[model samples]
Target: MISIEIPRPSRRIRHIHIEFGTLTLDYQAGAEQAQNVADQLAQGFPELMVTIDDDVRADLPPLPCAALWD
Candidate 1:
């Protein structure tokens, strides 16, 4: 799985939004892995918005046995 970490603005703002571009992962891993990653991120940035994208293409598969968040 490929992961991208984006830092939120420090200054207080009326609205906070987070956009995760796109994601594709092994079907075998299931949604649990995705949720785990999202959960971990949430713990670090409680106030920051979190978005998870799991629509990955099977045709363009990722590297074999890739590590999460690597």
Candidate 2:
């Protein structure tokens, strides 16, 4: 199995909105917020799929995964 590690959010994250199907999760958080969310959703990974909206950052080069961002 391939592992996907999400970068923990920092203070500047300010806001994050996530929606899937008819379910919507909207929140504002600080460091480690993403980790907490991931832990909550960890149980369903086998059946989960995601659609991401991307805005390329000029400051960083394209990486196979963004896990290193933090």
Using lDDT as the measure, the top candidate is 1
Candidate 2 lDDT over 1-70, as tens digits, reads: 9999999754543233345668754444432454444444555653433222233234433222324333
Reference-based TM-score, model 1: 0.33
TM-score of each: 0.33, 0.33
Write down the lDDT of every candidate, Cα atoms only.
Answer: 0.44, 0.41
As for candidate 1, its clashing pairs are 24-56
Task: Report the Cα lDDT for residue 68, model 1.
Answer: 66
Candidate 1 Cα misplacement greater than 4 A, ranges: 1-29, 47-49, 59-70
Estimate the TM-score for candidate 2: 0.33
Where does candidate 2 have its weakest 10-residue lDDT segment?
48-57
Model 2 ranges with Cα > 4 A deviation: 1-14, 44-70
